[model samples]
Target chain A: MERLAFELESAGPPAPRAPPVVVGVVASGNLEVLVEPGDLAGRCRVEVATSANGFAEIWDAVLRDFAARNAVAGLALSVNDAGATPAVVSLRLDQAVEEYLGQRP
Target chain B: MTPGNPGHLPARRSYREATARRRLAGILDPGSFTELLGPSERVTSPHLAGLGLAVAFDDGVVVGRGLLGGRVVLAASQEGGFMGGAVGEVHGAKLVGLLRRAERERPAGVLLLLDSGGVRLQEANAGLVAVSEIMRALLGARAAGVPVVGLIGGGWGCFGGMGIVARCCDALAMSEEGRLGISGPDVIEATKGVEELDAADRALVWRTYGGKHRYLLGEADLLVEDDLAAFRDAAAALLASPRSLDEGALAREHERLARRLADFGGCTDAADVWRAAAVPDPDRLPLLDADAFRRAVAAARGEEP
Candidate 1:
């Protein structure tokens, strides 16, 4: 497995009231994301432990895009991935954030 | 939106297809579920990190307290998506903790939404030991007058150690999609070859281990439709009638087992066992729905249909 960590500057507001939330499951071609409150000084952090190795660049791009699109400040997103595609990772990230914000679709 | 209050639930969905967390919500009262040792706690499997496998935050089993029809209850839902909901060191520890809590707290009942394929092969010995501890804890809870009920309705089904664990519960409510057996069809086919048991034949596999056959054979206590409300209702009703685990109960169970073996031990297929049970047309069982099959079995047993 490959462990990847990233800390990015957030463009959206910090989540102080939102509760921690988890989404998805760590299955083949799938992943689970846990979103918790973090004291990152208005920044977002992401940690990925994936069984499918050698995709650091793809994860980097996906997380960067997620940070830019979502209000993820003061939040730490941990992902347990099992060969999930970039799309699935992004979707789980969005889902975790939405659940954390007490919003459901 | 509280316990005993009817709230807006999702439209009818198959219990077998819902996620572990979703199953918990569907089973318990709306807005009364509070997850313990949840994914946020990050109490993941310690052994999976070294093996380079994905480790779930809640260790594939979600355990917590909730209200089931106005009564407080401790519950656990095994996530089949993660490692086939296999029992590892941490996963089994969570379940053990819940059962033990039930013994101490004496909640309404311990609801186990079992969907495992058994012990996690990745954890190997540790997983086996965890399952053993779980069995001990579960039986302990039962002995303490805390009813332990199980529901088996998932794509993976309950097999291996979990199957044994399911039988240890006071009662089991299974959906038509649920299956219960010690050795799974694929495992049997792999070990004894396709000639012994063809795993590819879905019909044969279901007939041998599915809910309908198990209920007919007296393995599953109640057989219901695949709907979530059906499972919830079944569990609620089962909680109202907790079976005893005293000496008398054990002796009766032993006698029943002995009688079953003596009468159907020579039978190789489930149809043969059903025939022995006096089901006039065993072949028609699989084709009938849960309600229809129940009626047919009742009719064959000379009960009011």
Candidate 2:
């Protein structure tokens, strides 16, 4: 397993009422994401513990893109991945944030 | 899958397809589920990390307390998506703790949503020990007047040591798709060869260990639809009337088993057992739906259909 951590700048923090949210499951080619409130003022911290190794650069790219798309400031995202592809990672990240903001469809 | 939906939907929502959290939400009262060791806690498997395997945040089982029809109850749902919901040290410990709590707290009931392939092969010894501990804890809770009901309808049918644990419950409800058995089909075929039991024969597999056959054999108290609402209603109904584990009950159970052995021990297949049970045209039984099948079984037993 490989561990990766990143902090990215955000536009603003989410609503204060947004409680901790978790989405997805840790299955083969799938992952689970947990989003919680963090102390960061204008940044979001993302940590990943994945079964697939040698993908730090890919993780960085995905996390950066997620931060760019959402205002996830003052939030921490933790991912437990089991060889999920980049597309699945992006989808789970969006789902985690959307669920945190009570916007799950 | 909103938390406060009340779950009276027109469409059939499959319990077998839902995640652990979703299943708990579907059964519990709206907005009443309070997870004890939630995902944010990061209580993952310590052994999986060392083995270079992905570890889940809640260790593949979701344990929590919730309200069922205004009564407080505890529930534990196994996440079959994670390592086939196998019982590891932490996963089994969480369930053990919940059952022990049920003994002390004496909740309305304990719901064990079992969907496991038995012990985790990676954490072999720890997983086996955990299954034993869970069984003891579950029986202990029952002896303390705490009703523990096992529900089986997960993607991975209950097998191995967990099958014994399921039978230890005060009551059990299984969907037609659910299965309860000691050795799984794959395991049997792997050890005894395909001629002994073809794991690829889905029809044979289901007939041998599926909920329908188990229910007909009086192994499951209730055979329900695969829908979540069906499971929820069955659990509620079972919590109202739990089986006693007293000396008389044990004696009766022993007698029942002995009689069964004498009557149908020579049966080679489920069809043969069904024939011995006085089900006319046993080959056609599987084609019937759940309600029709129940009626047929009742007729075979000389009960009102």
Candidate 3:
């Protein structure tokens, strides 16, 4: 297995603009995402670097869907993936938001 | 092999013979393990290759999905014979990734068979950060109601950041052959003088750093024989137990460690704490098999060792 890595950082405020928090961790076959508003810019930016070479397209789809859906501004999302299934990757991404930015469990 | 028999890990051999692929076979379940980044991955350290040292595939850590008692558990074990089981950036990432999977699947448990000297000095900065990240993931798993168990079975033991990681686990199972501490004996000896820990004095090293001492002090929860079968059983029993630790238990763990530091006060003689804990014959205690020792000591204290 290749060490497929993908990372994304965005500037500006969420669609509604809110507080900032940092979340995420990188491990084999999984990822921990941290999403919190910061002083980047008005537009959201995402970056992804992975050890897995051929999965970039899959990551693009997932992150694109997330950005389009959330549209939260000024927030940064950093991902360190170790070959996670697309579903698991997205779950952690969504959970990272819930943990650091979203409602309390 | 079982209690009556044994295996010589870190046995004198070539890298292929001393590899974790062979070691983990006996550690985890039979025919249930699927390597995540097996030898074929070739995930060697780009940084280490620059330093001209040999780098193994899987970044020196063997990670996979396996079962203990058929309870589908995520597993990662260090290769002690390889570069003292140090954690590099990719090595650390692999671990956090598995922890993420554990959080997602709520695997019956996650077992990290720790065997490291600490962060790799060659890639020191990233390695240090990675250890901290792994710690956060460990905490997250606990919060998510999944058990994170650290098993110290390697001959090299664990130290530095890895030592802290081992302590943060919900439970730790250790063999007497393993040692856990922030700094290793050689480092301490180099600075504090061999008179302190005496890196060459095998007895003193074991007494100061061995798993038996950790067990008696409650630093290690379950003490098992120095064989794969014993270690495997402890993992299975924990899976069968109620998943997460109750608050009361965590509280007691804190109290025990604090009391130990307060009372022991940086003493070099570990037997002091053992005797104070009412362990009979602290000197001979290290030689006893894990089960016999537990029956003798933990039974008297009415606490899990």
Candidate 4:
């Protein structure tokens, strides 16, 4: 098992009041994302726990891209990955954010 | 689309291969099922992430309400593809909540599409406690006169605590491929040695705890085909004639279970039990068709065949 954490500052303002959201299942080739309100000062904190090790750079790249594209400030995002590809990881992150904002994706 | 409405129906698929959501859709009336804690709710487990295991939004169990043959019913289906459909804290709690809801709402019946390998090994203690809670909830639902029907035909058959849970239901529906046992063959072989129970002998394992054997032993109420339609029809029939959970039925069940335990307490081989039940040529029983096996068991029991 591998545990990784990351923090990134977003250019946009903090997200509005929103409830926490979870998306996806933790099965082979799949992952689940949990997004909740955080006390970060215009920055998003991300933590990932994965069964497959040696994927720190991949996770960092994915989270960095996600933070740049989404206004995730003041939000905490966690992921439970089970050897999922980068594409699936990105999709679930977007889904978690969309669900947290109470919007259909 | 709601569960029961007929606007859209999924392509015909085998129940054994269908996902948990697909199974629920097939059982309920089209457009009638309204999930209580849907995936959108995102009520995931708080424990698995720490262990570095994957977590699911719905905790691997899908619980909701739907109309089965025009009667309101509470339904739950386990996702066999997720961690072998094992019951964890959140998954078990969902089931407990559904059963408790049945007690209060008093739906036509409670339908459980069980595909669990029992408690989750990762969260062993929590899973065991949750199963116990589910048992208590089942008893409560029974006391409230709510029928609980379990269907076991998914990739993983009911085992561990769930095997007993299925037996506690008012009725159980099973496919020929389904198995109902407390301990799996692997566990038994590991603990008692391969000589005691060969784990690799699939035929022997099936003969011991498979649907046909359980049906013959009067454990499973209905034995149908592997198709979803067969299961739906059986469920409809069961819900139509809800069994009363009165003292008489309780006493009968108690006596039946006690007699069963006492009758086969010392028997190691399934064939011996069959022979004691007066099943002629007990060795050939496993090869019989479902209908034929039912008739044979009834004839052996001196019931109308």
Candidate 5:
């Protein structure tokens, strides 16, 4: 999970407009996330700070998978967690991105 | 047959079962409770179990509608046995929804049997948002002439944002075994040293944070025994009573809370407050039970208990 203070980066076309950057609590034993459009167009860099450490590799792997599957670029993803596992985190992150993109005009 | 006794102890189970049992037996009549998203409905929190936490079908709070003294009532009760009666997303959602239903019905009133530590730290954001929604719903019900009676008699009592939520209610009732405070002894102990709050000092802590103390300080409207029947009766009576708060009364209540913070400025012990409130022999508080505590305090003030 990510802390209140988190940042991310991406490469390619800058977001044409400011995308919805939603951040907040997920649930107990759950995770909260923030996904916003960024300046990069082709690359996505994810940052995670979690209460449960020693799981950073899993977090990176989840992000890698999410990036590989989605055309989501120039976007930032951040998470805050109490004890949310990597898979659940990935799912929520994807959901947030999906929800935000759906809201795009 | 003895009065105030259900004559048989209710069946026991996990937090979910206890919640169902309590909700079923709490209202004015048997067979009156209609659960919103009960166990058979399977509205458990996907957010909790996804993270490997034991998730109950009801999440943590039981929400439903029933009859109380011939008037319709919607109520919510927390399950302290589960996750410290913590508030998760669905738990908070169910609560907000129940309050919404109460406002919609606007029949008798809404009752909340709260025993939560507030904002499930796991689902922090969702829980926080849900609490605000519940508060808004409560305010709506109040505007519609529905009184919101909060019962703070669970083992966990209330804390954090939930504590604030309970305070926002029109009135509150409690029992000796229950507590009502913003933070737990451990949290205080962690923030301050043991010397500051002394989590181990049960007597001091109880007098300072217990239901009896809050009742004396006027935080709780009713103080009764811990038996479930007592609570049920109190809820019935409160639901029928004229709602004492409206838009203006509520706005002024906030002022009273702020005054509490100011008047209680930097006090180290409850004994100080006892002396400040001018109770006789504030030092003699630890020896009193519920009845004795009430009697001693009242007598100290030259009044009948």
Candidate 6:
């Protein structure tokens, strides 16, 4: 298993206050993302645990891009990956954020 | 697929490949499934993340209320793709909660889309306790005159604690591909020598625990094709004329189970069990289709079924 954690600075203010949210399932070629409120000030913290090893740089780039695009400050984003591609990881992150912000009914 | 749109339709799909959400949608009246503790709730398994394992948002089980054939029902479907649909603490709790709701609300029936490999070994003790709680909840629902039906056609055959739980339900609807067994063939072969039970003998495995065998033995209440619509229709019919869990019915079930135990206590061969059941040409039953097999079993029992 591979374990990695990082914190990224967001461009805008923290996201709207809402309850924690989780999205997706962690199966082969799939992943689940968990987003919870945190005392991160204006940053988003991410921790990833994956069954496949040696993709730290790839995960870092994907999470970095996501944090920069979304106003995800003051939140902790955790991912349980099971060999999911970069596209699926990004999709789940977007879904989790949308659910947290109540963008979905 | 949209809420409150009776005309909305989902493309016909095989139940075997459908996801948990899709199964619920296919089984319930279109737009009638109101999920509780949905993925948006973030109610994941705390133990899995702590142990460096993957954690699902709904903890691998989806529980909620839905309308089936214009009747209110509580339903649950296990995500077999997630952790082999193992019953962890939260997963089992969801099922228990649904059954408890059924007991309280007294819905027309409770439908369980079971595709689990039983308790999650990662949280062994908690999973076991949760399964026991679910069993109690199921009995409570039955006592309340709410029929509990189990549908087994997921990727993972029902096994372990869940297998026994399925048997305890008022009725079980199974497909040919589905299996119902206390222990998996591999587990038995590994624990006991190959001479005791060969894991590689696929034919033997199916003949022993497959839907056809169980249906013939009266373990499974209904054997149907592996189509979501077929299962939904069967469930609707069952709820339309629900089974009673009255004193007399319970006594009869008790006698049937006891007789099963007494008849097959020391039996290992599948043929022996069939012969003991007085099924003529027992070797041909397993080769027949589900409908034909059901007819043969009914005929053997001298029933009008």
The model with the greatest DockQ is 2
Return whichever of 1 and 4 wins on TM-score: 1
Give a tens-digit lDDT track for model 6, residues B98-197: 9999999998999999998999999999999999999999999988889999999887889999999998798888887788999999999999989988
Candidate 1 clash total?
0
Name the lDDT of candidate 2: 0.91
Q: What ranges in model 5 sit over 4 Å off?
A: A1-105, B1-20, B23-27, B242-266, B298-305
Clashing pairs in 1: none
Stretches of candidate 1 exceeding 4 Å from the true structure: A103-105, B1-11
How does model 4 score on DockQ?
A: 0.34
* Cα error of candidate 1 at position A21, Å: 0.5
Candidate 6 CAPRI category: acceptable
Residues B108-220, model 3: lDDT tens digits: 88888888999999999999999999999988887888888888867778999999999878888887888899999999999998666779988888878888888877778
Which stretches of candidate 6 lie above 4 Å from their native place?
A1-24, A33-49, A60-79, A85-105, B1-12, B261-267, B278-281
> Which prediction has the highest lDDT against the true structure?
2
Tell me the RMSD of model 3 versus the true structure: 15.5
Instruction: For candidate 6, give the DockQ.
Output: 0.40
Residue B136 in candidate 1, Cα distance off native in Å? 1.2
DockQ of 1: 0.87
Please report the candidate that would top TM-score against the real structure: 2
Q: Chain A TM-scores, one per candidate? A: 0.92, 0.92, 0.66, 0.93, 0.74, 0.93
Model 1, B1-305: lDDT tens digits are 35676895546778888999999989899978888887878888878987766799999999999999999999999999999999999999999999999999999899999999999998889999988999999999999998999999899999999999999999999987899999999999999999999999999999999999889878898899999999999999998899989899999999999998999999999898888888878888898878899898998879875
Query: How high is each candidate's TM-score?
Result: 0.94, 0.95, 0.67, 0.76, 0.66, 0.79
RMSD of 5: 13.8
lDDT of 5 by residue, A1-105 (tens): 232332233333444444444333434566555566664556654555466656656766677677666656777665546677667777788787776777537
